[model samples]
Target: MSATMEPRIQYAKTSDGVSIAYATLGEGRPIVFSPRVFGDIHLYTNVDYRPPYIGPLVERGWRVIFYDGRGTGSSQRDATGGDLNRRILDLEAVVEAVGSDRFALCGVASGGPAAIVYSVQRPERVSHLVLVNTFAHGAEYFESIPSVRVSRDLRHIAEDQWEFYTLALANALNAFSDTETARRLAATIRAGVSPRAWIAQRDALEQIDVVDTLRSIAVPTLVVHDRADTIGDFSMLASKLASRIPSARFVATDDFARAADEFMREGEAPPTKEEQLPSGTAIILFADIADSTALTEHLGDAAFRTKARELDSALRAAIREDAGTAIEGKLLGDGVLAVFASARQAIEAALSCGRAGDEAGLPLPARCWCGRPCGRWRALRQACGLRTVAIRR
Candidate 1:
C-alpha cells in the first residue's frame, strides 16, 4: 500500500538539540503546511485517505513540507517546553533547516495565529500566507461556538483520563469525516503519539491569543473560513485578521474543513473583484421600506406609488449631494430598498426622505445606519439594511 511513492523523511537538530523530524515531498516552490494543534501533518501524505487538497497541490508541482511540532509526532519534545511562542520558534528552526529563506505558509485552525506571528517576526521570509478557520485572540466571545470548549473545562476532563482525551481530541479534529475515515484517524493517533502529550498540547492552546501580533505582518495573506463554523465564526475571524494586515484578504465559505483544504492548495483564486472589500474606508447601506404590500393596500396603489416617488426623489438628492452611492429605489408592492455609502449620510438621507413624507402628511418606513473608524461601512450596512454614500468629511 505504501509502495507507490516514498517520502524522504529526515531529522534535523534545532539550536536546542531537539531532533525535529520533517518530510519534504513534491517539487516546486516550498509550501509549508502547519496543521492545527491536534492535527498530524503526515496524514496529508498518506494516500489511503489524504485530505482533499493536498494531492491536488502536489499535482500542481508545488513542493510541500510537513513536520511535527516540537511536542508531537516524530519531533523531540522540548524539555523546556512552553506555549505557542516556543512552538513558533520551533517552526523557525525547521524553516531555517529547510534552507529556504522564504516560502508560502499554510496554517490552519490554531496554528494560524502562529503563522501570522512568524510572518510578522520574519516578514522577509514569507511570500504569501493562508489562514483557514483561525482566530486572532483568545476565544473570549466564542463560548457559544460549538467547535471549541472552555479551556478550564477541557483541562478538567483531560486531567482525569488523558487517554480518553487523546481519542476524543482525534475524533474532534476529524469530526466531519465519515465513520470509516474517523475510525482511521483515531487509530492513526493512537499509534502515533501518546495520550499524555496530546493532553499537554491541548492545554497549551488555551494560552494562545495573537490579536496584537497580526498587525505587523506585511505579506500578502488570504484568510478563509466557514460561514457557519462554531469555532468563533470563521467570517468574523477572517475579517479581523484581514482588517489588521495591510495586504490581507478575506474569503468566506460554508464548508468548515473543506475551506481549509482549498486554501492550503490555493484552490481557485476567487474572481478578481470578489476577492476583496469593494473599497477601503467606505460604507455600504441598504434601506428597505417596511410593510410595503400592506401600505400599498392601505393607501391605494396610485397614492402609495406617488408617495414612493417623492421619497425616492428626496433620497436620491440627499445621497448624491453627500457623495453617497444609491441603488435605484424600487417599490416592492408598497416598500422600497435603497443603498447608501456613509452612515451619517444614509441617516441624513433617510431623515430627509422622512421630512418629505411628513410634508406630504404621511409616515415613511423605518431607518437605521452604522459607521466605522476604517470606514468599511459594510458590516453596518448589512446589519441595518441600508444603502450608503461616501461623504467627503
Candidate 2:
C-alpha cells in the first residue's frame, strides 16, 4: 500500500482528561511513533509526508501510529501544567486506542526520553524500541552541549519576543539555513502552542532523566544517531545509551532516516522498481483559477497565458513546500494537480496555493474536496483533469 495514504485522525483522552490526537496508517504490526514536543501529528505527517524513517516500515505492511502530546497540535491545552511523568499517559492513551497488545515503538528527538521510560516500565507491551536523535537524560544533554544551554536560555524570550524566539529556536534546531523548512517549522511550533506553553514544554523536557532506567528495559532496542547533528552531540549520547542498555545496538550515521531504513531492512536486498512506486491509498488535489475564462477574455490570450504560467509556478511551489508531489499533466488547460501523503496536507497545499497566487498577482483561487476510492494511475489521471479540486483517498 502507499505510505502517503491519508490517516484518519482520532482522539484519545488521558486519565487526566487531556485529549490526545493520533493517526494510524497501513495495516499490520502496529508501530507507535512518539513525537517531539513541537511535533504535530497532522503537520509532521504532512511535512515529512513519506518520512524516510517510517515510510519503509509502512510499505512493509507495518501500521504506523502518530500522536500529539498535551498542549500541542490538535491535543488539549495544558491548563494543568506540564509534567514529565504525565507524558507517559499520553503514550498509554494512544496505545490503548490502537487496541494493540504489543507493538514496536519509535521515538524521535525529545520523544526519546518518554519512549525509554515507557519501555522500561511496560516491557511486556513494547516488542521493540527504537530511539533516534534523543538523549537519556536531558540535564546531561544540556550540560554536555553549550549551544543547547544557550538555546534553553532563549525560552525566556519566547513569550515577549515570539518571532525572534521562533527564529532563534529554529536556528538552534538546525533549520536556519533552510529558509522554507525553517518557516514551516516555525509555523508548526506556533500552531502547536502559545509562547508560554512552549516554555513549559521545554522546561519539562529539560527535566527528563531516564538514565537510571535504561538498564531496566528488556525489549530489543536500536539507538540511531546522526554524527553531525547540530542540535545535539549524538556521538556521545548514542554510545552512552548503547553501553547502558543490555544487548542494544547502536548505529552512527549522518542520515537518521537511512539508519532507520537499514535497521528495519536488516540486510535485505534493495527494493525493485515496482516496489519503489507508491500504491494502494493516497490523497490527490486538483486546483485551477476560479474564473479563468473571464480573465482570459478580458486580458487576451497572451496576457492570460503569462498570468497562467505565474499561477502555475506559485501553486507548484506551495505544493512542494507542503511536501505534496505535483503530478505532471494538463488540468483544465491552466490548473494544477498534486498528490499529498495526507488529506490535511492537500488542504493546506490548496490554501497555500491561493495565498501564493494572490501574492504573485495571479487571479487564482482554490477549493478542496476529499473522498476515498480505489484505483491506480488511470483514475488519478481522470481526476486530475477536473475543473474543481478534489481529494480522493
Candidate 3:
C-alpha cells in the first residue's frame, strides 16, 4: 500500500494556452510518461500505479517525468478538447519545459497514441519508445471490444452514472479482486472530471488511431500486450502494430518491466539485480465479513457456517462460469480469493459474488487504502493476457 512520494507540482504552458501540470523526478537519462485521461499526476505518484513502471528506472538513475494532458488531473479542466494534434501540444509543452534534449518515451493504454505521434515528429529527441496495452488504430479498439460501439461507449456512461462508471473501470482494470483499490480508483476518477467534461473530451479521444504513424517511428520501440487479455483481439492487433515498425522486433515475456529496462538501456552493459523486469500482473478478489464474531454471535455457529458455505459455493460457481481461477485457502472461513483473465470477466464475476453474499443474508465488508494498486493490477492483467513486443536491437 506504500508508494513513491508526491513531488511538488509544476506547470507547463501548451501552445493552446492550456497550463499542463507536471513533475520532474528521479535521475539518469530521462523518460517521459504520456498523459492518461482516467488518472492525473496525483494518481500516478501514488504507490499502486507508477512505481512498478518507473521505480526501477529511478533507482538505475533515469529521470522520469509525469504530467496531466489537459482535461484530467491538475491541468486545465474547463477546456476538455478531444483533438489529437492539440493534445500533443501538451506533450510539446512538457518536453520543452524540462529541456531534455533526448529521452525515452513510454505510453500505456490511452496514452500511447500521442506518444507515438510525438516520437515521429521529433525523431531526433526521442531515443526509444515503449508502448504498453495500447493500440495503433482507434477504430480497432471500437471494433474489437465487445458491445462497445461508436454510438455507445464510455461517454454515455459518464453522463448517466459517472461514479458507477469510475468504479466499473477500476474493477475492469484491477481484476475485480481488490475491493479497496477499486474504490480508491473510483474516487480518484470521480475527482478527475465531471460527467459533462468527460463526454465532451472523449468525443475525439475515444479511439486514437495511428496505424500510419507506426512505421514513421525512427527510434527503437517496444510494444507490449497481454496474450490473455480478453478485451477482444486487441493483443493480436498490437502485435500487428509492432510488425509495422521497421526498428521493432516482437517478444513475449511476463517480465517486460525488465524488457523495458533493457530496451531503454540500449547503450549500457548487461542488466544487474538492482532492477526488475515488469511482470504480468493480475487482480484478486475476496469476500470478507466486517465483524465475523459479531455476526457469528447473532446467527449461531451452525447457521452461520451453513450460510457461509452456501455463499462461498455461489461465488465459486460464478468464478468458474466466468473462467477465473478461484484460489482455495483460509483467507478466513468467510472469505475467498479468485483470479480472473479479463476486466469484463472479473467485474461480472465479482458482482455475482456480491449478490451471493447478499442473497445468503451475510453482511460482508472490507475497506482499502486506495492509491495506484487497483489500476496497476488491471493493467498487468491486460498486459499478461495480451501479447508483448520489444525493441529489435
Candidate 4:
C-alpha cells in the first residue's frame, strides 16, 4: 500500500449529541485506536504526514479506525466539560458508529484508561486489548514520576505560551529535536483544540484511576512497555498494570510497533517451530546524543555521567513510547542504538527522544539522529547486502 492513500473522515454522535470525528483506513479485521489526549483523527490520518506507526498496520491489511476525542481535533469543541464517563461515551459512540460487533482496541498513552474501562464494560464487543506506554492510574503517574509532575506545569505553558507549549509537547511526545516534525506536530496540536480544551483534557486525564477496574476486563489483553521509557519506569508502572489483570500477557520491547503487530495478530495460529523466524524487509533505526565530547567537557565527569543515564532513560522510554524496539548495541559513550520495525517508526522514535529529553529538563538536552537501513532476514542464512541513509535534524 502506498503511504499516500488517504482515509475518509466521518462523524459519530455520542449519547449526549456531541459529534465525534473518525476515519477508516485499509481493510481486514477492524482495530479501533483509542486516541491519546488531544488527538485529532484528521491530523493523524493525513496521507502527506501520517504517524509512521499506523502505516505498517494499514499496509498489512487491517482496517484501522482513528478518531478525535470530544473537545479535541475535528470533534465537537463545545463539549468542553468531558469527564471519564463522557470519554467512555465517546468510545461507545465511535464503536456504534463503525458498526463493528467485535473488534480490537489499541490504547496509546492516556487513551489506555478509557480503553480499559470500556473493555470491562463491553467485554462482548472487545475481542482484544492492547495498551502501550500507558499507566493504570493518572494520579499515580503524576505522583510517582517527578518529571511528570514537573511536566504538569505544562498546563500553565499551554495556557500562557501556547505555541511554545505545543512545540515543547511535540518534542516531548516525539522524543527528538527535529524542528520540522515538532512544527508539524505543533500545528496539529493547535488545530486539534483550544488552550481551554487542552487544559480540560489534562484535568480529565489526571483524574483517571483504573487500577481497581483492571481485573474486571474479560477480553484478551496485552500490556507492552519499554523499560527505558522516560515517562515512567516500566517496572514501576506498566508491569504493575499488567499484573493486575487476570491472565494478561506482558511483553517488553524497545519499540511499540513490533509488539503492537504481535498483539493485533493474536488468535491466529502460531507458526510452527520450523517456520518461527521472520523474513523480508525490516527497518533498523539507531539514535545517539550528538556532541558528547563537548557536552561532557562542559558538564564535567560526575554531572555528565548523571546526564548520560538520564538521556539513556529518556531515549529508551521514547523508543518504547513510539512502539520501536530498543536493540542492545555497543554504547558509544553518550549514544544508544535501537531497531525499529519500519523507517517511520525509527524516525518517530528518534524524534521523540529529543522531545522527551527536553520535557524531562535534562541538564544536557539531547538531539537524536536516525539512520534507516533495509535488509532481509533469512531463517538460517547469513544476511547479505544492506544500504542505509541517515536522517538528521
Candidate 5:
C-alpha cells in the first residue's frame, strides 16, 4: 500500500450477527493482525500513526489483514469487545470473509488472548502466532499492578469524561509519554469506541482467564513484549506465556516485525505433502462429567479447575495408552476428545477415562460416548480435517 491512498474498508457479519470492519493490504501469504479492542482501522492506516513495524511486513510479501473488533471502530458498538469468546467471533468472521486456508496470526495487546484461543482451537488453520504485549489471564495481568487493577473502578470516568480517560490511558500504555503521537492516539481511541462501550468491554475483559488453555497451543509462536514496560510490567506476563507453550519463543525487541519475520523465516517448514488428517474406519471417544455446571457450583471455580485439570490429564494418558491420539482442542468443554484406530482401542480408552473420572471423585459419574464414522467421515474431513468416529461406554 502506498502512503498516498487508504486501504479499502470492508465488513463481515459474525455468526452472532455482529458486523466487523476490516482492511487488507499486500499479497502472497496471509498474516492477520488482531489489534487490541480499541483499534481504529482509519487511524491504523494513517501513515503518521500506524505502527512503523507493520509496513515492513507488507513489503516482505505478506498479505497483512487488520480489523476493528466488536464495539470498536466501524463495528457494532452495543456489544462488549474484551471477552475472549467475542474476540474469537470477531476474528472468525474476518478470517472467513478474507478466505485464507492457513495464515500467520499477529495479536497485539489485549487481543492476544483471542489469537491464542484461536490457535489452540484451530491448529490446522493457523501457520504461526505472534503475541505482543499481552497476557493469558486478565486478573493476573491487572493484579500484578495495583494501579492498573484499581483502574477498573475508575472505568466510570470513561463514560463521564472520555477525553480525559483516553488521554490518560494512551499515556499509561506508553509509559506516560507526552508526545504528539500520544495525543493522536488518545483522539483515535476516543473515536474508535464510545465511553459506555469501553466500560462494558473492560468489565468483560476482567472475566477472561485463558491461562489454562495456553498449553494446548502447538503452533510455532513468537511472544513479544518490552523489557522496560511500565504498564503493569507486562514483560513478565509475556515471558510466562512463552515459557508455558510447547512451541513458543520469547523476544524483547523494539523491531518486532523484523524479528517476527526473521523468526518465521528461520522456522518456516512448508508442508511437502497434503496435511495428514484421520480417515478410514475409526472410532472417536469422548468422556466428560455429566452436568458439570452443577459440579463447578458445588466445588467452586478454583477447586473445580484443579480437579478438572487432573482428570483431563489422566484421561489423555489413558487415551494414549490405548493407542489413541487425544484431540485436545475440540469442543470437549469439561470433557476430552480422542480418536482411535480401532473400536477396541476407542472402547478401552473410553472405559479408562470413565474409571479415571470416577477415581478422581468428581462427585458425578463421568459419561462416556464413542461411535464410528458412517463411511467417508465427511463431517470431519470437510470441516476440521480430524479423522473421528464415536464410542459409548
Candidate 6:
C-alpha cells in the first residue's frame, strides 16, 4: 500500500440528497470551519493555515473542523445546483453529522455568508463566531461601491484556460507549497469537480444576499478584515454588521494573502539585503520597484495622475503620523526617500503604502531596503550614526 498521511477525509449525506466531505484534525473544543471550496482544504493547509490567528487557535486546544461545501472536494458532484438555501443546510448538516454541537465557527469569503445563515438557522448549535475577510450580503460584498462590481466571470478561464484558473486559485490562496505540492493540489481540485459544478457554485454565490438577517446572529462574533484585501471592503461591511449586532468585535489585520505569499517558501532563503555601519550595526530589508513606469502607462494619464496625487497624499499623511520623515530623493522617474527611525517602522510604512495602492485599485510601485546602513548608504557612513539624507519633493 502506498504510504499516506493526508488529513483523514470522510463524507456525510445531507438532507437535500447531497454528500458532504470533511476533514478533522487536532484536538480540543470543536471549532468548525466552513471554508469556501476554492479548492481542497488539504491543498491549502500549509499555505492558508499559517496565518497567526488560525495556527495559534488550532495549537491552543481547538479541534478545527474543516469541510468542503457542495460541489467541492470529495463531496458528491451531482449535489451541486447553485442554491444558497441548500448550501446553508449543507453546513448545518455537516456540523450535526460530525456530532459537534455548540461549536465555534470560522468562515472566510463566501463561507462567511454560509456560516452566518447556518448560525441563524441553528443558533443553539454554535459557540463563538469568527468571521474573517467575509461579507454579509453578496451584492454588497462584490459591489463595494454603488457603481463598481467585483469580477466573477470565470467561465472563459474555467472552460478553455483551465490551468490558469487553477493557478489563479492557488495564487489567491497564496499557495505556498513547493512545485510538486502545488501541482498535486491543483490537479486534485480539477479532478475532484467538474467545470459545471464550479459554475453552479460561483453563480449561487453571486446570487446570495443576507444583509437583513445579520442582526439576528446572537453569538459572540469576531470579525477580522485585511486592510489590503482585494475581495471586498470588510471595513465598511463589518462596521455595518457590527453596529447592528450588539456583541460584535471588529479587528483589522495586515493583508493575510500577501503575508501568506511572502512566508510560503519555508526553507527557501528570504530575500534580504544587509550592510554594515561604522558603528558596527547592520540593516537588512528586501527592496524592489517603488514605482514602475509601466503601471503609469497602463493606468492612462488621467487615472495615473489622480493615483499619483493620492499616493502623495497618503505618503505625506504617513510621514506626519510619526512613521518617519521622508528624506526625499528620486529613484528613476519615481520619488525616493530615507528614514532615520527603526527599520521595522520603515518596513511597515512600505507595506502600508502597498496596501493603500491596492485598496485604491491603483498599481503602485514599491521597493524595500533593510540591513546595516553601511557603505551602501553614504549619508549613514559619513555621519557614523543616524544621519538625515538630502530631502527632495
Most accurate candidate by TM-score = 4
Per-model TM against the reference: 0.58, 0.64, 0.64, 0.65, 0.63, 0.55
Where model 1 places Cα greater than 4 Å from the true spot, the runs are: 1-5, 45-50, 77-82, 141-144, 150-152, 170-181, 226-233, 253-393
* lDDT for predicted candidate 4 compared with the true structure: 0.67
How many clashes in each structure? 20, 0, 27, 25, 8, 13
- What is the C-alpha lDDT profile of model 2 across 145-174, one tens digit per residue? 655666587767878999777776766565
Report the C-alpha lDDT of model 3 over 61-83, residue by residue, as the tens digit.
57879888787778888767756
- Model 6's alpha-carbon lDDT is 0.56
Per-candidate local distance difference test: 0.57, 0.69, 0.65, 0.67, 0.70, 0.56
**Residue 177 in model 1: lDDT:** 34
lDDT of 6 by residue, 199-284 (tens): 67767777787777888898777776755433335678766766666578776755332232222223656433122111233222
> On residues 1-393, what C-alpha lDDT tens digit does candidate 5 reach at each position?
012225688999999999889988777889998867676475565533454444456645578889888888777777664677888988999999999989999887677888999998999999889998787888776766544664575676778888888777776654453446557877887877888777777787777888889889999899997433335456777888899888689998645666777777785653221123246555666576777788768655533554565566566667667887766233535766666667777777777777776776664343333444443444443454443343233
Judged by lDDT against the true structure, how good is candidate 1? 0.57
Which parts of model 5 have CA positions greater than 4 angstroms off?
1-5, 40-42, 46-48, 145-153, 179-181, 226-233, 267-393
* Best of the candidates, lDDT: 5
| Cα misplacement distance, residue 243 of candidate 5 (Å) | 1.1
Off-target runs (Cα >4 Å) in candidate 3 are 48-51, 145-154, 226-234, 271-393
Error of 5 at 236 (Å): 1.1
Q: How many backbone clashes does candidate 2 have?
A: 0
